[model samples]
Target: MGKNLREPLLKLLIEQKEGYISGEEISQRLICSRTAIWKHINELRSEGYQIEAKPKAGYRLVYRPDRVAPEELIPHLSTTSIGRAVRYQRSVPSTQSLAHEWAKEGAQEGSLYLTEEQTAGRGRMGRIWHSPTHSGIWMSLILRPPIPLNQSPQLTLLTSVAITRALRKQTNLPIQIKWPNDLLIHGKKVCGILTELRGEQDQVHYVVQGIGINVNATESVWPEELRPIATSLAIEGGRTFSRPELIGAICGELETLYDGYLSYGFTPIRILWEEYAGMLGQEVTARTGQGSVKGIAKGLAETGALLLETHTGVQTIFSSDIEW
Candidate 1:
């Protein structure tokens, strides 16, 4: 096909699965020819779709793969922009690096770069992120919000709320957020967010928010040292989940909250964040470049900074690592 037909065609087949959809009807609705539909059907089959075809009958959807490709995700997605355009690969050095490059190359806002594995995945503070193949979510989302450069970090906080709220609603899991961008289940780390921006002194061009989730990975996926503090959804939930479904749910929640954030301000998202926050009322240490501050994890400031209730008073920490 001249245009991208896989996404819409997949959606049509999924929605019209009450019986076999005739090829003539698909071509008419999608505004294509029967031959073109046949070509795309073959393409989907190559990608592990079990589409049944019969002469003079049509196509019937048998099964779909557990892949995170756009064809597999479009049926589950309901957002206007977020995850509308996706760049997928089996493995990469880093999806964050690709998002930066693609954004500079004029990729659209809300373009998502996804990978099953990342050989050199990066975390905050230049740490290496462990990315296992076919067992986790290693992806980055591109956003071009019309916010000031200093306010970009709020998107990171908004992302934690989006993912946590989505997972909680879908699975009834007790997922909670740590200050800034970490999500935990039962006090063990399940997801982490790393936000980077391309901006000038006053204006922001775009923001690349990378999110890593241990979705269906088992205990062996983590390194021996990480077992004490790290966890995956399968470990806590005792079952595996569809990665594409989780991604769609997160994107839907994100697009909603993101639209609201741009309209009003951070007030609404901040309120939701506090409700899902973890480690509050617990004594913790934040290590900053100048020094360290020990205080109780109270809440967040308006600028997305972690608020700490110390003995002296409430200390507002901007950039620091939390130690508990």
Candidate 2:
């Protein structure tokens, strides 16, 4: 069985919606032998797909696992190449780490790497991102931009805007962007973005933007520490969302913003991001390695740094913990 045969077989099974599909039918439609069809079915099953097989009744797709695959997402995706090329894994240590390695090895820009679960997912400031199996979107993208290294933080802001837009498109839930790189739903954390860059002294060589969204995680599925403050799309929307749809939306928005940044600059993205950012124009506390500072969240600077109006004066905060 070839790679091309799997997609048509899956689509046929989905379209048929019948309890069983005969091996003779699959073999005829795919123009392959029954043995070849069986081989491909086994391959699909190995990839966590649940298929029921009977000696005479043939096969039936009992379950389609919530995993990000190029075949599943690309057909419905509306973008140039942001998610056109995907490397999907059932489980991995970290999608970001894998994306970083791929980017370093000259992977194409807009390449996406996703996993069903991440064992060592991380968030901003070295925080651990809870990515459980079959419950969230654990994905990373490789981007090659001509922007300077100092303007890299803007990428994080851009990603936030993209994710927020995607969530809004799929569900009517009100989503807000926390300062820097957190996505909140009804004032609870629902998503986090971690952006990393590898470059020279002046120019950015590549950037790996990692995003994790709590899609279908239930209250009991979350850790005790996060139950109070964390949430999932299912909890917020009262239903589970297609991870592939959300991923496609995010990748499309990202490509749009990336093109905008290259043409006009970060000014447009900064404006849009500020509109959705939480704590802006409100009293907030910022915790940094140096110390903590209380200030009013004025807005973001043109360079994407945090503009904090402190007691002494206005400050440009590049990175810090935001508490509102």
Q: Top lDDT: which candidate number?
A: 1
Model 1's TM-score against the true structure:
0.91
lDDT of 1 by residue, 1-324 (tens): 553888888888898775788998999999998888888988888878899987777899999877788777777889999999999988899999999999999989889999989999999999989999888889999999988898988999999999998999877889999877789998899999999999987888999999999999887877899999999988898999999999999999999999999999999998899999878888999999999999999888999999999989999999988886
Single out the weakest 10-residue window by summed lDDT for candidate 1: 66-75
Once fitted onto the true fold, the runs of candidate 1 whose alpha carbons sit more than 4 angstroms away are: 16-18, 31-34
**Which ranges in model 2 have alpha carbons more than 4 Å from their true place?**
17-32, 46-62
lDDT of 2 by residue, 62-166 (tens): 888777776667656788879877888889999999999888787998999989899999988788888998899999989888988988899999999989988
Q: Candidate 1: give the clashing pairs.
A: none
Prediction RMSDs, each to the true structure: 2.1, 2.4
Model 2: lDDT of residue 62: 86
TM-scores, one per candidate = 0.91, 0.91
